[model samples]
Target: MKDMTAFLPYASTANRPPLRPKLAPSGAGASAYATGPKAAKQTQTLRDNDDTELLTLFRNASFEQHFQPGSTVLLHGDPADAIYLVVSGTIRCCTVDSEGRRQIFAFPKKGDFVGVSDIDRWHFTAEAVDHVIVKSIPRLTLEQELAVNISLRLEMRTLMGGLLARRERQMLTLVSTKGPERLYRFLEEFAATRSGGGHIVLPMCRRDIGDHIGLSMESVCRAFSDLKRRGLIDLKSHEKYKLIGNAGRDATPLPLHADL
Candidate 1:
């Protein structure tokens, strides 16, 4: 097995931006987003002057390009020549056991950074959960930028710290809770962090949420039912939710136990 302990310190230094406060539709505002395959194809031609400048400076640095869903972006032992950024779609970071059971580490949304392991190679594999577009930047170049740009370096350090903290909390929840509580906590957290108001636009499916939260798909569905019955949330649609009260207030009173 890969020695993840040694890399914990580095992982602790990433993902610190304030959560984007507004809940705008994907591709509805000034924020740049790469969606499906068609949008990814159009990104190259649609760039304005600023976009072109950034893209050109990093263009010579090439990484692997693939357009397939369920494809492995990086295997457990593959060299981390570069950090992979999701240009479009979702990428699931996960670890698999010798028995081939998989536990998802995180679901990196658009604009999230992946492959932050300090070592030369990744300790986990990143798989495309949908059709994806990824951009890879050389480690050397990243280091160079960090060395020269103090602000950028600090930003990266903060981002890494936040990401590590979030993952650590998720791991703790996975080991200590039942599927229902885990699913509830996951939705509560997602709603609070990403959704601006009562409306929540879910980026991933029930199966994806189940994998990440250490729950079966059926359990996740049942938790949603419980939440709705309690009048805590409403199912706006399959991929959307509307919070009735504060999203996570119900969870606040519960004590942490081995099985929640």
Candidate 2:
């Protein structure tokens, strides 16, 4: 597999740290760093040796399997036995309509976690957008850890919070913004997160982004055109954008970082 870093830009700030796989310990008596407010709060803790060890434990304690591009990792309503970590490659979480149209919920990159739903079954299907390697942690093991590990508890809490926040933001964009605004914001946010020296590589297709942002495919195309026209972004081609600096750029994009 290609080095995951090669596929994406580096973190923009020197102070920013790499993401780690370990969930912080949960339960009482956990360190303050492990616990978050009832709401999600962004934290920038570095990935330490402990976190690396935890990832190793997670991978070795269970088994890892590969899925070819277009393979389904979990179908909607399937039993949610384990949470998946994308060791490499991309996965799209999506839901299908009664008419059988697929609406992608999210495109998770390498190092992103998937299937963290609290329900016994998955609410959406997870399919490999590319050849994918996943480290699976049994749900029971995760639950057990959550019961005892304060740090993990906090980490999980933060993760849930971040998910909710992202969903809320997406919902607002769908309801309140036009297609061009949504697309511009999306590209701007993607660019701001990068090392500031390179273009943002979109891991998914325009159709996938359209579904997530509640835009029609044609509208998604128009939004890209609008951004390019405004000189906010260079449409390097479909699914790629180069930030050229524009007004009304996303403020949170550069500052936002997450563990999963």
Candidate 3:
């Protein structure tokens, strides 16, 4: 592969693309965009440059597959011939022990890519949490592109790096955080990924939460109550929760193994 570093400026903090506003400005056109239409156009161009390239690759090379809730989208040890890019709904990736214990690795949602790390066979099983749609791109196609497309190569590296970092953080949290705090942290991160500001739906049930965070269903319920009592979260209903007051950011850090 050629040097991909030059094609991946958006991957770095210093050169990352500008954020697109939820709504365009309302003032005079010149003042609204900070420096007139020319600057605004430039900003838009920079933002869409790399994103358009990647989107084109997926759109041109992938085929869509839909899965119903509880359906297995990918099985552990299955041939890893394609990468699935989530289009809608959630996919829970997990592994089960010989004793039948399950540990969830991730709940990948829209815009997330799966099976990117697999070499020959899947290491985790992916199940649809609801009606799910994904675009599957064959590994051979991506590899051929990567051989000549520097931007795609760099983007792949960036994606893998992010996945590894997230897993590392999850492992550290599981070992060092209390159950209640763990639940709170998960809500915080989950809400951040979602679009609805402080309000978001819990796509998975309490049992799923327990499996993901290493808690029992009863313990998960208790942790929810604890968070509600602490004024960190407001449970609107069985599936909806609203974050309150910094969402426990002000709480003192719990000692490692405090739940023990």
Best by lDDT: 3
Task: Write one digit per residue (lDDT tens) for candidate 2, span 106-137.
Answer: 77766778877654966676766666677777
- Order the numbered candidates by lDDT, best leading: 3, 2, 1
lDDT of 3 by residue, 116-141 (tens): 89879777777767667888777888
Provide the global lDDT of candidate 1 against the true structure.
Answer: 0.60
Model 2 lDDT at residue 29: 18
The window of 10 residues in a row where model 2 has the poorest summed lDDT is: 7-16
Q: After superposition, how far is residue 226 of candidate 2 from its true place, in Å?
A: 1.7
**Best-first order by TM-score:** 3, 2, 1
lDDT of 1 by residue, 1-260 (tens): 37533333212111113212132233121112323223122234333464332243234443434434554566565667677666667777876555334567777755567765554877776666666677766688777766776766666677779988987887787898776667667777666656476578776667667768877777788878777766666888878887666546475653333232
- Please list the C-alpha lDDT of all candidates, in the order they appear: 0.60, 0.61, 0.69
On the 0 to 100 scale, the lDDT of residue 106 in model 2 is 75
Q: What is the TM-score of candidate 1?
A: 0.64
Error of 3 at 213 (Å): 1.0
Q: Between the candidate structures 1 and 3, which one is better when assessed by lDDT?
A: 3
